[model samples]
Target: MANVLPSFPNAAPTARILHFHDSIEYESRIMYSRPVAKALAHPGHTENLGLGVATARFAESKAPDLHLSPHRDNGDPCVRVSMLSAVLTNKALLNTANSSLKEHYPENFKTRNACPLDMGDLDRLGRWHTRTVFTLGTPDTASIYQREISRLVSLHPYLMHAVLAMTAMHDRFLQSSDLPNFAQSTAIECYHHGCAAALFNAKLSSQIDPLDRNALWATAVLLSSMALFFVESSDPEELWPLAPPSPSHLEWLNMNQGLRVIWDIAEPISPGGLFHDLAQNPQYSYFQSKMTSEPQPGIDGIPYYFTTLYDLTPLSNARNNPYHAAVRTLASLLDVECTPFTMVKFLSFPSLMRPQFKALLKGKDARAMLLLAYWYAKVCESQWWIKTRAILECTAICMYLERYHSGDLRLMQMLEFPKARCRLLRSGTSRA
Candidate 1:
C-alpha cells in the first residue's frame, strides 16, 4: 500500500533497511524486506495469525539462508530484513506503520553496510548540535532543547523535520570540503521539507496545548537558528536588492519575538521551566557584570578604547535608549568571546537591535550609523568566514555616513575607532 522502501528505477539493490519496532505496540516492519514474511510463514503461524493474500505474494521473495536471531536483551525473535526484495509492497502493513517509523526511529533507518566509525545520521547530527550549534548564539540551551526534541518527536512531525533540517544544515556548514552530490541534495530536501512541515503545522497554532506549546517554542528556536544560517550563507545584498520596508533581519527578529510570545503563553504551565531558567540564567548576569565593569586589557586584548567607547558616546547616559543599549550589549559580546572565535559570527547585531534602533539607522541618524559601523567591524574580526561580508557592510555604513554626515568629525572618529582596533585584534589572541 505505502512504499516504505525507496524504489530504484535501475533495480540496483538497496544497501539500507528501515528496521522499526514499536516497543509499546509490539509491532515491527521492514520495508520491501522478505525475511519478515519468511519468519511469519511457518506452520501453525497461519492458524493463529491474520495472514492475508498479501503474505502469499510477499513469501515469493523469501531467502532460505536468512534466519531469525533471538534478541540479545529480551530473548524475543528478532527479524533482520534485507531491503533487496519487494515483500513489504503490501499496502496494509505499509500504511499502518509508516507514521510510526518516520517519527520514532531516531535515524529513521539503519544502513546495512555501515562501517564501525560511521555514526547514523540522527546520532551524529544530534551530538554535533549539542556540542556546537546550541552555543552558536544563545548558550546553555542544548540539554533542554535536545531533551524536548527527543521526547516530542514521536508526536510532532513538524519539530522532527525541523531538527532534521537544522542538523543537515549544521553538517553542511561544518564540512571542510563540498558535501557529496547525494548528501548535498538530501540536505536541501530536508531543509525544504522541514520548512513546509512547519508552515503546515502553523495552521493549527491556536489549538496547541501547553505541552505542545513547549515543542512549538523549541521548533521556533531551531527554525530561527536555521534561518540565521540561511541568511548568512545567502548574501542579504542579493536577496534584498531594493531593501524592502521590512528586511530579512527584521523578519528574523520578529520570528524570535514570536518565540517570546509563545513563552509568555506557556509560562503558566511550568513556572520554573527551562526557558525561564535560560532567561534568568547566572551566565547572563556574569556577562552583564563583565560588560559594565572596567576592563583589564592585555597587550593583545581588545583595545582598552573599545572597552570604554560606549561609555564615552553621547548615548552613554541614555540607559533607556535601545540603540545605546544594543551597542553596549554587542561590545560585551565581543569582549567576552573575542578570542578563539567560534560561534561569534552567528551573533547578529541587527537581530539584537530593537526596531526603534533599526529605524534610527534607516533614517540616517548619524550616531546610530556610527555605532552600527563599529559593531560591523567587530563582527568582521570575529570570524574569518563572515569577515568579507561584514567588511562590505562596514564599508557601506561608512559610505552612507560620509554621504549624510561627513562634516561631523566626532562621528567619523567614532566610526574609525573600532575599525582601527579590529585591524590590530588578530584571531586567536588571548582574551583580556
Candidate 2:
C-alpha cells in the first residue's frame, strides 16, 4: 500500500490586509477539507511523479477546454503550486536537520565547513538552473550571473552552494509535490553551510582575496534570487487568500543593498567586461524610444518620473534600460485589470529590473526611487502576497523619501498614497 504523506496543515488565520464593507458583524467557524488521492501517495517516502502525470490527465479529462498540452503542463500554475509546497516542506526538514546537527555534533558548528555537498545534488541543481533560471534573463545578454556562477564551481564552494540552493528550489516546482524529496533538502543544507562559511570568511579576513570577494557577492545575488523565487512561486489559492508577502520578499530587496555594500568594500568579479558590453547594447535605445512613444502625463501629474527615465537611457548604452521598462511596465500594470496569471507575468518586474537598476539605486536618484515606490503601489493592488508586502515597501519608500527628498514637490505628490497608507497602517486600522 502507498504511504500517504500528511497534507499541509491549516495555516493560522491571519490579519486581513484588504478593505471590507463591514456593515454587519457575525461570528462563525469554518472548516476546510481536501480529498487526498491514493494514487498520489508517496510510498516508502519516495516521490510519486507518476501521480503528477496522472493528475494532469485527470484534470484534462474534466476540462479539455484548458488545452492542457504537456509543455503547458510544465507551466501550469496548479502543478507549480503543489511542487512549491513539497519543496518548502523539504526545506523545513533540512532546517531541522541543521538544528539537530548543531545540537549533536559540537565540532561541526558550521555546516558548510563540515558537511560535504553531494556531487549528484550539485549536478542536478546546475542542470536545472541552466534549463530554467537562465532562460529568465534578458534576451540579448548571456546571463552574467549564470556565467559567473558556472566558472566559480571549482574556485568557490560557498558561491556554488548558494547557486545550487536557488536552482534546487526552482527545480522543486518541476517535480511532484506529494512525495518525499531529497534534492531540495540537500540543496538547503548546502545553502546554510555555504552562507555561514562565506560570511565568516569575509568578516575575519582583513584583506579579502578576489575569490572570497566574488564568493560573498555571488552568495548575496543567489540568496536574493532564492528569496524572490519563493515569493513568486507561492499561490494565494492553496496558501491563503489574503496574506502579506513573506519576509523572504523583503530579504530579497535587502540583498540588493548588500550587493551594493559588497561593491563598496571589495572589488567584485575581476573581469566584468560583460557589464560594459551589456550596458552599451543598442536595444536599450529602442526600448527607450518605445517608452517615449507612450502618451506622457501633464507636468502636474508627476511627469518627472517618466522624463527622468528617458534621461537615464544614455547612462547604460547597451543594457536593457530598467528605468524605461519599469515606467512602461507600471503604466501597463495600472491600466490592466490583472488576475493571478497576469500578475505573475508582471512579477517579472523585479527580476528584469534588479540587475541593471542596482546602479541607479546606489546613486539615490529621487525620481527613480519614487517610480519604484509607484510600481510597488501598483503591486499592492494585485491579489497576492505581494499586495501587502508591496504596501509595506511603499511605506518604507515614503519614509526614505521624506528623510532625504522632502523638499522635492513632485516626490511629495507622488508619495501621497504611500503616506496615507502608512498612516492608516500605523493607526492599526488596516489589519482586520
Candidate 3:
C-alpha cells in the first residue's frame, strides 16, 4: 500500500510564472552568444580549439564574456586585417629564427638544443636587445616582433579571435593570393626569414635547426609563457603539466655531456699513450685504410660549419656516461684552497664553473655547487620550482656548505630564521 501526503492549506504563494520565462530568455541569450558552429567553420579550428582551451584555462578570470564578434559594434576591418597579418607574420618570424639558429650552431642545435628558442645564452642577448630597442624606439626587428606580439595579445576578444582564425586560414590565404611566383615565394620565404631575423638579432642564430624551426617558435612561446608565470604569479604545474620531474635526469645529462665533450678535446695527449701509439703505428694505418674513407670536410663543409663558427660541440654521446674528466676539472677548482665565499662566488664564472661542477660531481654529485647555482638562477628568473625542487635543493646546499665550513653559529642561525616576529596586544577591559 502507498501513502500520499496532501498539500498544505496555508502555504506561501508560488513565484510568478513571468520570472521563469525571463530566466529562460536570459539562458537562451547566453547559449546563443556562443558561436560554436561559426568556430567550427574556421580553417584552423583544431588549433583554435587548443588555443580556446588554453585561453579559457589561462585567462578565465579576465575573460568574463566568452562571446566574441569582430563584425559586431562597427568594428574596424583594418583591425581584423592587422590581427591576421600579425599571426602569419609571427609564424614566419619563428621559422626564420630557427633557420638562423641552424645556420649558426648546427651541432649543438642538432644534439643539445631543447627547442628552437630554448637557448639560454641567446635569450639573455635577446632580452638585452629588446630593452635597448624598445627604450629608444629604434628600428630593431626583434623589438618590433616582440612589440607586435604584445599588442596583438592585448587586443579586444574579437580582434584576438580574428588573429586566431587567420592563423588557421594562413595556408588557404597563401593558395588563393594571385601574386607572382617571386612575390608568392617571398611570402613563403618571409616565414623563415622573420624567424632568422629574430634569432640573428638575439645572437641565437648559431643554435637553430632547420627541422626544428616550428619547435623553436613554440619554445619561444613556452619561454614567454614561463616568464609570464613568474610575472603573474601563476602556477607552473597548471601551465606546464608535463614539465620534467624534480632532480631532472635529463638536465643532469645535458650538463655532464657538455663537459665530456670539452674533456675529450681539451685533454692533452698522454705520454706513450695508446692514442699516440695508434697514430704512429704503420699496422694501424692498414686498418684505417681498410675502413671506409668518406671525405671529411673542414669548416666549409656541412658538419664542420656550426662547430667552427660557434665553438660548440654535440651533447648526445655524454648522456648516462661517467664524467671522469669533468670530476678532475672540479677537483682542480676546489684544490685552489679558496674560502667558501670565494668558491661560491667563483662558481658564478661560466668558464670556471660548468666544467668544475661536472668534474667534481662525476655525474653522481647531485649536490654540485654549479648545479645549485643553475637551479637558483632559474628559480629567481622564472620561479618554476620555488616551493618544490629548487627551494629544497638550495636549502640542502646551504646546509651542506655550512656543515663543510663549520660555519659560525650566528650565521647558521641567521640562515635558518632571519625574520623577526612581532606580537600585538589587544586593548580591552580585564575580566574579574
Give me the candidate number with maximum TM-score. 1
Error of 2 at 369 (Å): 15
Name model 2 segments beyond 4 Å from true. 1-112, 125-129, 133-136, 139-142, 176-206, 211-215, 231-249, 265-274, 282-432
Against the true structure, candidate 1 reaches a TM-score of 0.51
How many residue pairs clash in each candidate at the backbone level? 2, 6, 16
**TM-score comparison, 1 vs 3, better candidate:** 1
lDDT of 3 by residue, 1-432 (tens): 111211222211222212222322232232223355334324344422211101111121121121336565367887677666644544444454444434443243234321332122122223322332132111332343334333322211212222222232232223432211111222212222222222222322122223222222222322221111121112222211122333322232232222222222212112321123343455334223221122222222223322322232443112222332222233234334333223222222222333344555434343344334333333321112121223333344454445553444533443332111000001111110
TM-score list, all predictions? 0.51, 0.39, 0.25
Model 1: number of backbone collisions: 2
Residue 119 miss distance in model 3 (angstroms): 21
Q: What lDDT score belongs to each candidate, Candidate 1 first?
A: 0.40, 0.40, 0.28
Q: How does model 1 fare in lDDT?
A: 0.40
- How well is each residue in 1-432 modelled by candidate 2, as lDDT tens digits? 112211212211111100000100000000001112121122322332110001111111221122234465567788766556645544443344334333322232243233433323434443533553343334343266556444544345444445544555444544534211222333243333234333323332333443455545555445544433333222222221123433222334543333334433333322443233544556433322321223233222324555454554333232345466556556556555544335533554554454456456555566666766766665554432244445555666676678777897766876786577545543442211
Candidate 2 vs candidate 3: the TM-score winner is 2
